[model samples]
Target: MAIDVGIIQDVETLLKNLNGYELLSYAICNEECGAETYEWLAGRVEGILVDEFRYLAKEKRKHAAELRKLFEELYPGMKPLEFNAPPLDTLPVCRELMKTKELENALAIAMLSETIGRDIYRKLQRMSGDEEVAELFKRLAEMKEAAYEKLLKLYEAMEK
Candidate 1:
């Protein structure tokens, strides 16, 4: 008795075909860029909130100490997401998908940060396997849930 196990995993092929960032960034950017105008305050608001999260992650010096370092290594910028970024006062409606790579790259980065935030709580819950930390994860998850809700509201506004 034998089984025909003809299975192969092509790592390089998989990597080449993977638009991991593109897919995720597209989701994040389109959520905002889908707006009637990127100059629209909605996109700008969400962008700023996302930036604030990056700051918090950087400042969490106790438990999540290495987060900022890893963030820098993975992406080395202030996300070009200024607290007071260039205004959209007179710019034409940026109604098209990002034409150049820079905007798309920035969006990809934004998605990555959101993703890491999601992972942190989820991972803590899994790794806790105990009373205290598990409870902490539960609390953290709820926090994330609220943040997601707020983000959805912004996205919904963008949709309008």
Candidate 2:
């Protein structure tokens, strides 16, 4: 598919406008959505894939918790944002992959989502003026890259 430069620019503008708390809240929501998606997948897939999904689910939740902690520290008494709706636009793509109940589809979605996430985090890191927030975003981008590589490896293995 062709890259949507317009959409990318729109998202960049949105990210640039977000304050520290808003950025952290957005990250937390994305992590929670990811955790929920993986947990749902874990219940559907069997054998080794189930275990892998469960691990991914756990890691996603951990990411959410870490982001929440940071948000709390930054905004002492404020409540963290709730995951009441789809966090990111790609979340529906994940839901579609889950509905398909196909390992290949799930793996493909994971790879795509991770790449998008990494890019977003990199952009956020660069746009952030706060050193701590920038560092956190950089770390998140690195983690997303690692996850993307893992998903790509799994997808390739399944193709063979």
Query: Which candidate should be chosen as best, given TM-score against the real structure?
Result: 2
* Candidate lDDT (C-alpha), each: 0.34, 0.76
Model 1 C-alpha lDDT per residue in residues 31-69, reported as the tens digit of each score: 232222223322344444445434333332222223223
Give the best candidate by lDDT. Answer: 2
TM-score of each: 0.33, 0.83
Candidate 1 ranges with C-alpha deviation above 4 Å:
1-116
Tens-digit per-residue lDDT, 19-101, candidate 2: 87777888898888878877877787766678877887788888888888888888999986554654453543544664666
Q: Report the Cα lDDT for candidate 2.
A: 0.76
Query: What is the lDDT, from 0 to 100, of the residue 134 in candidate 2?
Result: 85
- At residue 86, candidate 1 shows an lDDT of 18
